[model samples]
Target: MPTEINFDGIVGPSHNFAGLSPGNLAATQNAGTTSWPRHAALEGIAKMRANLALGLTQGILLPHDRPNRRWLASLSTDYASAPPLLRAQAMSASAMWAANAATVSPGTDTADGRCHFTPANLLTMPHRSHEAHETARQLAIAFADPAHFAHHAPIPAPFGDEGAANHMRLARSHGEPGIELFVYGKSGGAFPARQSRVASAAVARAHGLDPARTLFLAQSPDAIAAGAFHNDVVAVANEQVLFVHEHALADRDAAYAEIRQAAPWVEIVEVPADAVSLADAVSSYLFNAQLVTPPDGVMTLIVPVEAAGHPRVAAWLETMLAGNGPIRRVETVDVRQSMANGGGPACLRLRVVADPKTIDPRFLVDAAKLDSIAAVVSEHWPETIVPDQIVGTSPDLALVQTVSSARAALLRVLALEGVLD
Candidate 1:
């Protein structure tokens, strides 16, 4: 006989708010209909944020350093699928004429902490007039054709459209050469993948993953708008997997339960409805701050965050850790403040990429000190220059130096005459 199951229990939701739906909040009864989407989005985002944090603490292998690189890799089919601002900038930049040719342009690498990962994108040819055509030619030559950079995967082609959106994450799966991806059809614009279903197959073949192991998850098969899936995938250890599922606008318990039961070894955790504050739909700070495990307990993240729901999120995470070696959160210098000034620690950093071990988290943090900066500039400035006066004059290194030197000379002349302030 099989051994009797002796399950301890999970700290997650018990009933899982089985009956509550975010859509049920009455607009007329609550605040107003205008705020419904905001509230609903926030509630859902809370759970999603929690999922990201949990996954991170669990060591889901997220790229800590090059966040943009990883984010962009998640897109391939069409840049237009991206948000308006992003799409606009991307299109606008590639409009240069010279960008059509295939030639490597100079680009700053990772050592400087700016943008090192996009080396192949160095060929920047700007265009005028026939902008779109020039961009296409340049991008093709620059990257050896769009298809070459198309995640190098084989996916099903949608009928008539001949394109499918395929998303890929590069990493080793612990067991079974299998992977699962979540893709949602985008509405309006052009989702070539929607008509072709090509991206799915493209993604599978590109990664050389087992066909059986690759599971494609997409919601709203018939919807015109691309939607975020309620499904948040987890990278599992062995034969077991767990996913916390909930529905929006509708009681998706049946659909969720079905998916849950399909994997006997997989446990389905339900989340409580009250987890999010209605004041906002979802909080990004809460999710990013959640401590997911380090895959091998090998990775340590040193994030410099400023006012990102860090306090409340950190407190909640600490309680959940169960004292298991406990996570350590190091708050480095405020990068946001730096970025607002058109620079960041990442921008100032010069990293030694030899061992990855050479990356001392303190290097950037140490460099952020105001006194250290003042000292570095002090040696470079003339003896007559005053650091405080230079700052008051301007932050421009050249301008500040010139003004300081002039002021310092006046001070020296006055001092020689016994005149002082």
Candidate 2:
């Protein structure tokens, strides 16, 4: 049997408001505000616990070290000597959004029958560009069994890869063959289009996916301008159901035709533009919700509180639930800290469909392990982090030490002390 495991990132100790992501509206709007790293990390852990309580498989990804010393050293600069902008980029805790970790092709979809993972280059933004190597290393450790898991280096640049954030897989069952939908943006009026056609095709080829079972589509330019930075912001899929905004794709009718041709059983739930405008969808992150199949086989939509708070979105969800559809219930999760940084429930995890027994046991989690992680966060994570404190010539260098110490405590708690090294 195939099991879907969610590997959620532990919000980093240096979590703060630097506003590095260009297309992320929340990040831009919340720029320079004080951030609560302790609360962020604990909130992340609570979300994982909630998933576990729902009988969903949960796993953890340790937070990447902030003041990314290695990335700084590569440029021959130290924290004290670097410019404030560069310093802020290096100290970013963007890795907390693991949805961009990698584009994964489960064994069921690959020709080799070995699960494939290609860590995203994320070359569009300086803060995220440094993530590929570290993410690759962590994925290797988590999926160590060579026979069942295959780890591949990120596709070279000029082709920006943003990982599973722009990719979605749909199948009748986790163990069955599935269609891999790759979404790329041609252009963003002001911001750079992060995912490219070349990168999407390359990832599909690298995973040895069957051409007949794969679909590559262009993301709507309008959606990108409306703060749909990644495809997940406007669309998401699970099993045979696809929940997407009307403006999610460039050619909605054609995309739907192709999807139906590949999987005739697909249920396309198109949220009408009149019911909830694209702007509202982006603001509420209505499509970023997690579509899951609980043990009872009824599909559930785990959404962020922001979605529930939106009057139109909430009303639309109620109408949808009242009808005969794959989504039977809608459950709300807090994740407010992540939300402030422009991520939602789906942004916090990387989903891998595989048999649990085949994966590295160390990455899996239970109630006791969640408690230990929460304890570490409470003990070492700072209540608030001021961006200015870690920035210029006379910046408070002690902030770096504090972040390092917190990461160390978390590493020990997760038994991944040297994982980053």
Candidate 3:
């Protein structure tokens, strides 16, 4: 039996709207709005509980410390001396999107018969670049059994790495070896291309994946320019099914050919361009849906509430679900707080296929842990955070103290007080 665990990042106290991501449409459109850290954290916890209720193995990834002292020290500046954007980036809670947490190769695919993880360098954006180190540390601790898990550092940069956001796997069964698809973007008009061919190849080699079982596909430049910054924005796969947009890749036919050759049993479901334009797809985040095979063994789509509001997307979804197919149902989740910051259901997690007994107990989720986390968020997290509090001539000292206090409270709840330190 294959145990697939979903590890979701706990929303940090510094969750705010700073419009730091260039190619992310939501972050740009909702630039300076007041963010509710309390609501965001609670909403995320609720999502985890919902997944657990479905009989899925759920885990938690602790948030990275904000006002990162290492980052500031590297720049040779304090908060006051640092640039406004730099300060905001250092305090970013963007790590909440755990999809970019790391690139995972299950034991079934590796030569050593041990799972491999390479933390994403995330060098595309200043806010995300600092996440790799902390992500590696957290993964190492959570997956401490070297006999079962092998943790590797992020790939060297110049070749940007965005982790599993640009990677997907397909197999006949979770226990069997799967074909790993790595999507790289050739050009990004405003935002830099986050994943490179070199980086993808490096990770595959590091994981000891067979070359014949790996496929490298280039992302459509048009999609990247239109704010489909990461490949996850336009494509997702689960088990033997791949759900994607028509314009997701530069060479669709070639990519499909490669996929079919490697995994002939795979099913490809392509959404027509006429039905949902690239713009609509990016805005609605239709492809960012979570494709999960629950206890019933039927695949379900867990999408954001925003998808139901998009006319074309909703119609297409209804039509698709009306028929008998791999995707048996459509479920909507309210992650508005995360959606406003350019993350959705899929972005909130990193999927790992491993035995439950092999994982660290601290990262596992249960009803008691969920209740305790909810309580901590409601009581300690800030109700709202305005842009002025973190950005501008003089930052608010009180806001800083509040954010720090909230993180401490969370650490205490998880019994991980000194983990990050």
Candidate 4:
């Protein structure tokens, strides 16, 4: 009964474009632009609906409390007294990218026979560093069934960990024991390399994964310099397929060799840089696509509309599909809002391989549940959010009230008001 369930983060009402991430090109390019929270949330729900329609299990994680009062207080300043930069950091809805929430090792790969989760201590970014507390709390709630799950607190810092964004898993199937790939970054030109090698090792140990079945590889400096902030941005793995850009790893040959040794069934589908330049790959977020296997046993690539529109990416995908490639079909969804903030479809989801029944039911959803969540989003989420409105010399009390009420309305409808407590 074990399966891969994608737990997506509901786009929060305070979603905005402050360009807080230094290495994320899209977020920087779109900074100061207006954001549509309602539209973003609806697009996300629509994505979940698409996956649900594909016969895959789907679940969701609620948005974290924004203008994180606790984080602000830790910095010795309240929202009203915080500077513009501080205010911007506190109000970030970056948590909407659930992939950064935790690093998961399914029961099949753990020593104790229970799925293991380690909440990431995103210490590299000021805007994201405060997320672990809320992320950990929510992970505890969703995976509270101790019989099948074990949740660990964030990895202690000085060790920056970005969770599943820098991790990948390959198995014969979701229910089988498989190899775990952990990609760490050494240097990234002007951008901070977020995942520390030490942090990844700690997570592997915490999850009790077999050393022989685990691989710790360095992310390509070229890819990171070109704005592939996380490994998922340049490569994504599902089951036996490793769909990646040629320059995604520091040494593709060594990485591939190790991967093949660990998981011989892995299909390395590398897109040559000549065919699709790294710039094109990152901008189009081509590799950020979610490569999922549906019920029909055919593997499908769920990509952002950006990838579908990019000339090189589209052409490459067309050729790949035409051939007898492992990825047989392509499905594009509009996540322009999340993309603008440097997250594509893969970034919006956290993949947990487990039985649907083992997860908290409140987090699971069907078409009807999605419709209800969409209704709440449409009725309450902000139509638009301008950066200046949330991060000026003094907080815009009206905008704050609007975002607060919007989330409250959603919780009430989902009957998850307990999340706030």
Candidate 5:
């Protein structure tokens, strides 16, 4: 039986919200939310400090507990609409979100939960299977399949770019079955066109799959190597979809043709300028923790809700209601306050596998308490990485987790006004 996606957690850093997405910055300066874990600039130096202090393998930014609902609705609607995967979403309390997610079904998973969908990793995410599996293991402990106790959720600790096989190995060693690994032949990041190919090769070598069985590199029309950001590809209810770059130097045509051979039932297309390609967008959503729901559903989209004008939001609202998707059931609200607190709709929420006996779809209800969110969009990113030319990458987790402090303060003020909840 094939494993399919039911839902997925969107991931990505929201620049419109967090002023402090750690990127390539210098170390001589003081570190704050926006300047935490950047790339190679003052990187290793800063990481040394974090490693000693908090086991900082990588500087991941997080939202302050409460999420933006407006953004989530937008995201959910985007997912469930026509063209499918590139437009899916989930629900949040009072905001909305949107992403290039294709589906929620996993093509394969180890007994532990290490999963594999397709080349979305090759195109977008440099390393995502390892990340999500880690999330399941370290944070949620959800992938503890008994048979593969040691290999459950093959999450890489010192995560190196080993490619899909390494990721699959980690997942499978922990208990997943054999996954098809896409092989690429390069290694660099500046030219995203080669990202898919390079990532595919790197992942295969990492997993050390049999070179014979592995479909070695056969350059796509234009060097399409990487998959979408964060390895976010899904197949839902037999429907499949994923985002691809419309014009990234990579061969969009080859990608469509080849990925289909294995992911035979997927919906692949070019990324939209108005939005990141559905594949890349998945990582973007994950970076921010956005969801996929519908229009009428209240959501808290956390990113630059204000960056795109109300009309854009309005346009977004309209675009969300396309087919038999979920957008029709949502309502949108722009909650900038939550963005100010470092998380938009997606950041604060996570998608976990359900434990039938105790599942609660309202995963975020308790986390959204008035005083639960309290950080503000970091007001200090441009100062950190501009020196290096690595334009857009957020700093660290401390910048955007939960905003307990601010929420508490709000409660106090509300209490003083005799309107506390």
Candidate 6:
């Protein structure tokens, strides 16, 4: 039977704060600060372990080789000689947020009856544009079986695409056919709007989704201007439940009406703006929580620790839990490292609905596999990355070797080298 399997990105050894993303408030605020790569990676593994404990299937995507040598070569520069700004962009760990990896259409929702993956071009952000190639390579490997999956190249440029970060689906169960929603930004005020509506339509068409079931919605420009770079930053949906902020969509009433019309059984759980302003929602990532239906049939919200600490979010959550609601339980995980870089728990994963047995086993994990990955991370990842290491004029050979070797060690431990190459 098909089930929701979350494939999270393993934090890379080159994980650092270069402040590359323009609209991501956390990334900009923490720019030039110290970074802990080893800690970051272990935290990601811990999150996977937590989800595994919840009896949810978990999968992982290996980090892309950093200091993106190929990209540098294209620009007629190498990391050692590239300008400081360019070097930082090349070394960015933005790809660690796998939500932008691809737009996924589960077998049940597609005409071909096979899971379809369209890697996002990510053309809007300079640091992230080069990711599609590598992401496609990884997806091709993980879902390589022809009988079960179909892979498509990214939607070509002139149209920016940010993949699943701007996508949501609602249904009664993971195995059932569902309503897919594509949220695109028209204007972001100070920030460039990523995920063009045209791109969203292209993906829906490519996936062969029924027009009646696919809804193209506009993201609130106000929300985007307030640093909600992607719709996922202000909203997330799981089987039949859409946990969203009041201002997440341009027209909440119309969007909700349309949603209800398409999937009449959908339970729209809107967090009031007066209780949690868009700014607080963005900061605490209250709406970005992963809303999932666990085995017991009670829905749970997997949130970041920051949300649990925020006063307004905590109070609102307490009230919500005290009363009877679809979200019956709350679970928090520490991903401060990724959080600092503007990724909450929901940002760190790409949800794919498929039978686990059809996917490449190496890509899936259990406690033992996580143990092996954690051991490699603890033993090989850099302890710390000072700002100078990334933005300094001269290249630090020691840092370079450490980052390269750390990933190499992980690939060797997993016996999955050349997968990224």
Tens digits of per-residue lDDT for model 3, 128-230? 9999989999999899999999988899868899999999999987788999999998897877678899999999999999999999999999899989999
TM-score of every model versus the real structure: 0.32, 0.98, 0.98, 0.99, 0.37, 0.99
> Candidate 5, 43: how far from true, in Å?
28
Candidate 4 runs further than 4 Å off: none
- The digit string of per-residue lDDT tens for model 1 on 263-330 reads 33443333233442211112211211111233444322222243234455344334433443224342
Clashes of 4: 0
Off by over 4 Å in 5: 1-140, 147-159, 162-239, 272-421
After superposition, candidate 3 runs with Cα above 4 Å error: none
Per-residue CA lDDT of model 2 for 1-421, tens digit only, reads 6788889988999999889999999899998898999999988888888898889998877778788888999999988899898899999999989999999999999999999999999999999999888898889988888999998889897899999999999898777899999999988789677999899999999999999999999999999998999999999999889999999999999999999999999999999999999899988989999988878788989999999999999999999999998899898999888999999999999999988898777789999998988898899988998877866457778888999998998787777777664
How does each model score on lDDT? 0.24, 0.91, 0.91, 0.93, 0.27, 0.92
Candidate 1 regions with alpha-carbon error over 4 angstroms: 1-178, 185-198, 205-208, 219-271, 277-282, 288-319, 322-421
Higher-lDDT candidate of 3 and 4: 4
Candidate achieving higher TM-score, 5 or 6 = 6
lDDT of 5 by residue, 343-394 (tens): 3333222222223223222222121221221111122112222211111232
Model 6 TM-score, 2 decimals: 0.99
Model 4 per-residue lDDT tens digits across residues 338-368: 9999999999999999988888898899999
Error of 2 at 286 (Å): 0.9
| Candidate 6 lDDT for residue 154 | 95
Candidate no. 1 TM-score: 0.32
Measured by lDDT, the strongest candidate is 4
Candidate 2 stretches with Cα past 4 Å from truth are none
lDDT of 6 by residue, 321-383 (tens): 998878899999999999999999988999999999899998999999999999999999998
